[model samples]
Target chain A: MPLALYTVILTQIHSSNKVVQIFGTINMSVYSSQRIALIGLGTIGISMAALHLSRESNIVDVFDTRPDFEQYIHKTLPIYMSELPSPNTDPRSSPESQPSTSLVASLVSSGRLRIHSTLESACASATIVQEQGPENVDWKQTTWTRIEAVAPSSAHFWTSTSGIAASIQQAKMQDKSRLLVVHPFNPPNIMPLLEIVPAPETSAERVEFAREYFSLPGSRHRPVVIRKEIPGFVGNRLAFALLREACYLVQEDVVDAKDLDTILMASLGPRWAGNGVFESYQYGGGEGGISSFLNKLGGTMQTIWDGQGRINVEGDERTEWKEKVIAQVNEAYGTVSAEQIQIKEARLKDIIGIQMKDYNRHGPEV
Target chain B: MPLALYTVILTQIHSSNKVVQIFGTINMSVYSSQRIALIGLGTIGISMAALHLSRESNIVDVFDTRPDFEQYIHKTLPIYMSELPSPNTDPRSSPESQPSTSLVASLVSSGRLRIHSTLESACASATIVQEQGPENVDWKQTTWTRIEAVAPSSAHFWTSTSGIAASIQQAKMQDKSRLLVVHPFNPPNIMPLLEIVPAPETSAERVEFAREYFSLPGSRHRPVVIRKEIPGFVGNRLAFALLREACYLVQEDVVDAKDLDTILMASLGPRWAGNGVFESYQYGGGEGGISSFLNKLGGTMQTIWDGQGRINVEGDERTEWKEKVIAQVNEAYGTVSAEQIQIKEARLKDIIGIQMKDYNRHGPEV
Candidate 1:
């Protein structure tokens, strides 16, 4: 069964302005009504649907192979379709199972989202085909191949894969330049930053269109170009770098985990809300600013920036730390049951949702 | 003429709860109205007075060698008394030019903030003495000797010194236990975190009192203790460590300064509001958490923990960098005159002030 374009939701349709439209390379214009077909209903895929559906009325169609997906969809989304793999299908025992791609079809039948069988049916008259397949290169290549074979040449192909270059995967398709990457933050529904990395083969017109489409009202989206394909792109590379040092600091016992948190929360974190790291340093060194800061403290910092301390990843050293952390948490605010924690998490999610609403309403002031 | 506390201010008596009394060691209580004498009005002294008067009703009698402080105080604070150093105050001249060591009679001048000529007059009858003297040990020793002789034993001594140990300075005072370091962050009027480091010889009771004094209501203060003195304390050490890497990264051209800032702003800065580096990793790695993060990425991090790149503080390197950084700023944000930049900066300051007021009024929920 082919997914219908009427299933599309105008997530951010500005009636006065009409729906936000993006002109794709193949003369396809993506509006609010364009049906979006998603393959692989994993963590990333599920989060994308949650974000998309939370907006105006963007209908998301999903497919997966899991038999118990109906239960999961009930937990993850309000409305979804459900389909089970045929009883005759056995990924291990039957060659038919390989062709069926049961996982792909299961994504739709989960009752929380829509799903379709063939790529032609999934992307029939669709404006966009978002491939949320596995991170592995060969797997993505195969997925793109299938998408290209089934979908019309006019459909814009987007991948939610991180760190993988669009060109590498695009080469598997006939119209390679039509593909681009929209790597979003983990739990994309909650975080708004989306790294839009386009292939060298991708055109400026197509890239601009994707940027505009992602920036629809009510969507907390920020896009930065990869410029060139680099491992980890921009955000992750910097994040991983910071995380790496944080780990070494903990492992070395330079400061306890709790106090280290206090150091940041009480000092740097609040300042960071208004200014980023470089800008904070810009103000921190006073009139002399960043230059003075570098001159006065650079030597001291070099001394402290010793080789990475050995990490205590194994349970032995960390077990004590783990218990201590749990104990400290319990001490500060009594130990919460799993259910209570979940309830609190949900409330936090609500607060975050409200914040996004306020942000959308106000927009970025500067 | 010892500076008189009761002589200053409108003295609008409010309810007991509105008084904001901070209980000190033993049965002594320090009210927000306690006259705080600020000695040595240098950069640190000026900043401290601004912060103290920003919210508190502390009568600040400030003394400085420079006579032209009235213009600055008039602009920043509604309350303050300024005193000029004796005329012909030159070391090269006769010793008679310098004010006598008995500072009480010479310095104190009756005003909203009683200007004091000597340390004795400045500390006389004051509940707290905030010393912003030179960082030189000899200068501090001489100043403390005079302060101890004149200040009542009941008064608590607080030093706004950096890097120097509280214990080392306390050894010169009669009331050693009452002396503690209240090292505030740069631009103390803006940044709220205060390092509440006590000397080894200082009593625990004094530590508790100091903490309470800074954390009073209407006071946007965060007090952190260092059980033992470490050069630069916790915040600076941690801050400098991060800064060194940023500089090194810029020098190596791994990333531009602007891009580095953008990466931090988009990727990890927001997350930092809720969780610091350690807590962020603890949560970032998922259930396995910090341990898992270390296990997976620790090796990769170790590979990149290289030494700081070349930095030239004087002459060619600095001059070149200054021009380059300024040009980069202009290129990024467009050409603007210094006056225009200053206007932009002032606007940012106003925004920060409003945000801070809102945060203090409503607490961190905003």
Candidate 2:
């Protein structure tokens, strides 16, 4: 296919779930039942496994050093799956039959969701790898090299590293083009954003493949192939920008931490949820659109940016800014426990579910 | 009522919509029935009128210099109303009667929704005034002074000014305490936030009154009282911080403006929609809570902030940064139009409706 046609196909696939064939390439069915290897069992890894295994067409292989990896997933998979939107809930999309038993039970019993005794065993038949290992530089480099030794030479490698760039992670690998960063927003399964950061050596074709593959069935992930590596990628960088200003406001006693959260939840939060910052401002521009908004508000925006509280502390030791903020956070939210995380995750899931449903009914941009 | 009791009652009112009467003060039923006068008939003013007029008990009075103000509201209101969640849709909230005719027709045909021939006539009987006048300091000062000359001396004031602090606007007024900024996020009727900004002279009692008043029947508003009058206030300040960084990234060719928006819409937008930045960070902290998150990621956050794009340019004329960003914006979204905005607003209303419904079913905090 022409490169232009290939790009168009990828964009077009955003709305449909039919089996996509590239003639000379692989066949990607609705579920794309590929042999997938999950190398780690962190929260992200577990979430990814649950999502992949639940898709009836996937054959997920896993290996974790933990003695109780099977029991761990057995207990956690159900909890994660419970929060996901019911499959085929979108009336606009095609529907498929669900298995009679619990998804985890059915997958496990049928051996579609397999646990290998060794890393080599897990990678032996795998065509794809999702490595959510420890966030250490040396650890990732060594792990990828070992996986390469056993896994298929053609097996594509992905990492969930939030901070590390893919170039560093793929340095030791022989097939550099196959390895890259597909960092997610915390839980890999739920958040729709996947920052696809390919190393300098990674191929363009592989980037498209990663984008299409991550966006396959049973995934809410919308892959954005990052043009070039930047620190913190896109989402975190944007998040930290807001976070820095929030920290400054609280430090200055402009508003309490709780009120800061309340203000965002009431206004900017929901506004952005439905519309992007740029588009929201474009709407604010009235009939003139974005250029008009930029021309009119660019000065005010610049003024606010100049006045933002400086909270760029370099060390790990608590800056007075961080100290005041953490104190406020505790005072406002109290000592958050595991149950607190559970409650928030549930709410986040429901929030995303509502978004996805609307996304299905009116399309994603709507 | 004692001051302590008065404050407690305001907080309590958040959960219940029953008649909240302070023995010595005025009675506030579920639908306060407050006689509200709206000055100016711009988009904000028209939307505010629609919201206020829809409530069964409100006696809405509106006036604007534009000769077509009456005809404009007649045509614009129904569109805004269409975007709001259906009145009393929350099953958890008490049921209310609906007028048989279209809300605008029913209210206008009756004396309940009055469009006065002059500003003096509109404010003549109004107990609470919602001013959505043009964005000018002198215009506001003169308008408020004029309204105060005729309106009830006891009338409380609210302005929809995004800039020009209330203190500056109220400097010329006799009762500065009554005229604080109850700034709404764009279209006041549909968006759920009302930023209550008080001048130093503004009394505490008026703050609570504005809070309860804006949040009455047929309103989706959740008021957050600004502790101090910072420039751009909280929501806009946070928004600009993110925008500045986005502009920088796009300018630097790290990402296109469209992809930047895609990253946000897919991740942070919806994440923050369901969760506040602080609360979300606290969740990211896991069992360790906000303190852990701060300790672990604070350094990285600081680094990102230190490197954020600085686009804070003063003066209204075009800046290179602004030019690049505008070119990119036009390139990405094409020419934005009135029709485009309508689509977005409809989507925004649905997003907020979904949010509000969830909020009702499981308390706001849930």
Candidate 3:
């Protein structure tokens, strides 16, 4: 990574109106107009902060219960920042690595990413409060209540919970409309799947506001507005349903774990990465679109469904399946190594970069 | 797409020997030493022929029930062959298109891709006979019987059936051990997922032989040997399971088709494309590995499983779900236009190319 100075900071407006201003070193240490208070700096919180820092025009006050989180951020957050797709990339096809390490170091030195000892201090004047604390319902309720009391009334409250409905988390809150789940898949800044799941009470205005904020100019994040808060939500439900059958296949000895993955990576992986299921089938239907596809193959789908095994992830079945999967996964690929994980992460980032580039050039829609 | 000629054809040995022998155009039209008889030139047959022809060394004898099949191959086979990843590509990063039209024209003019009026004529003197006839059982049985009677006694008999067990297809044949299901997903040339599903009677030697054949040097195909023939084989079953949950979610009004697709394309697509199911979960499990993941999230998975709704595609529910999906898909994406289809195909190919490049560089194995 080249040494790129943070001498100039530009704040990109999230709407039709574009505003730009220059800040000198005198105000370089000072935060930008947007004060995003990211509470509970675990996976989601740290990642969100890194994303904000990448913009060079935001300030994030972060706090977590863990005492060593500050040090952890110093060590770990740079990796996430570095993996982010290069901004204003000239190449539209392949992903290019950006020199983000020095920029992160500069931001850290300038105190743009402030550390707060108390949650109240973090939420004191936050424009947006993103909470990614423990998954415990009681902890979430209490945390929201506390943050709401300290945070400005106009602050946009966001939770990073995966399964917990925002309505439940906001039950004890005074301003229910302000709170909603802004769940990121994991390592928030890197993976672009930021699901903005609004509770029934969450104002439509805020949902739209979030849609714009997370999807700023040149932003890589793909924020999806899930209409309702179904358990596991849309993404996880889709993933686990596929996984259940995957596990069942392994258990049935139809194919081992590695073979199953090879089959998928070769076929469905690229298919979904490009068009997803419905559109892929639309193509499968030939000129008839998805309608033709359902007519031709829907019956077979039903047969497969009826015959699909229900994997019991609990009790003895879990034990039996686990033994089988672990042995097979280990046997085929052995224990996952850091090199393997690194390569996997690199490829994931590259594909996402390719998608984002297409999204930019072709306005690649859903 | 340089105008690389078939003036020199090389037969690549599909094993450790990696033999390469060049022949002049006088010998090129005569085909390579390995004569592959492709019975039934529909989707699978045309694609398999294209894949084989990509290697100048391969001579595929083709036959189809359709009367206009010869013209169809002249027009359609080029497209499939063109889409196959370029041979000995240097970049190892992005896909580069080749000037394959002239090459295909040359191959056709040279009579390298031979078309037969009868299946017997196509398979009569072949070293390997791959059958991709209609889905009807009787048709498959009759076709196999005819091919087995005329095809060389030692010729490998392979079927491209999706569901029918090899045992059932070979029931009427004398040499049952010689025949098995070597199904390729959709277009065999473009897709690499070739499942070699052998029945109880299929010799282990034959299974290994099929594996070696499909996974030849620099071959794009990734073949998986299914221990047993299961419904939908493996790929379709996994896909339909995911699609089932997808339909259920749409039926419950949890999300529309486009949003469901957006959620998947943004999250699971790249994840699976890069690492696949078990491998992705291995990373998902963090340091403790997949065991830790099952232990931590197994309960939530069970809850999601219990609450999951079954989508019945065989009855009234099919109509209801179909109406909902068709409307939503059309509304969100409009009718799938040819341009849309083209872009989708390009992206899919690009991602697959990226994966293949990684496979080559990292020696990426299942």
Task: Supply candidate 2's per-residue lDDT for A144.
Answer: 90
Instruction: Tell me the TM-score of candidate 1's A chain.
Output: 0.67
Report how large a share of the reference interface contacts model 2 reproduces: 0.68
DockQ of candidate 2 is: 0.55
Q: After TM-score superposition, what is the CA distance of residue A133 in candidate 3 from its true location, in Å?
A: 1.3
Model 3 CA deviation exceeding 4 Å by range: A1-32, A88-111, A317-319, A359-366, B1-32, B87-111, B317-319, B358-366
Per-residue lDDT of B281-303 in model 3, one digit per residue for the tens? 87788877788888888878888
Question: TM-score of each model's B chain?
Answer: 0.68, 0.86, 0.84
Q: List runs of model 2 lying over 4 Å from the truth.
A: A1-33, A54-57, A81-85, A88-111, A316-318, A336-343, A357-366, B1-33, B78-84, B87-109, B313-319, B337-342, B358-365
Question: Model 2: per-residue lDDT, tens digit, A132-197?
Answer: 988889999999999999998767788888888889988898888888888888655567888998
lDDT (C-alpha) at residue B178 in model 1: 76
| TM-score list, all predictions | 0.67, 0.87, 0.87
lDDT of predicted model 2: 0.75
Candidate 3 lDDT, tens digit per residue, A1-366? 101132122323314344433332322122334678987777677678878777766777888778787667777777666656666643324434544446555676797888778999988978888888888899999889899888888788888898789999999987788887888885455577888999999987678667767877667888888888888888888889989999889998999999999999998887888877887776788777778878888768878999988878897654467789977776766676777765666567777766854522346453
Model 2 lDDT tens row, B116-224:
8899999999888888877888999999999999988878888888887899999799889888888888756567888899989998877877887666654578888
- What pairs collide in candidate 3? B1-B98, B1-B99
Model 1 C-alpha lDDT per residue in residues A116-225, reported as the tens digit of each score: 54545666655678877776889888888887887777667888887468988876777887888888775454455677778888876566667767765545555655
Worst lDDT run of 10 residues, candidate 3 chain A, spans A1-10
lDDT of 1 at A2: 13
Better of 1 and 2 by TM-score: 2
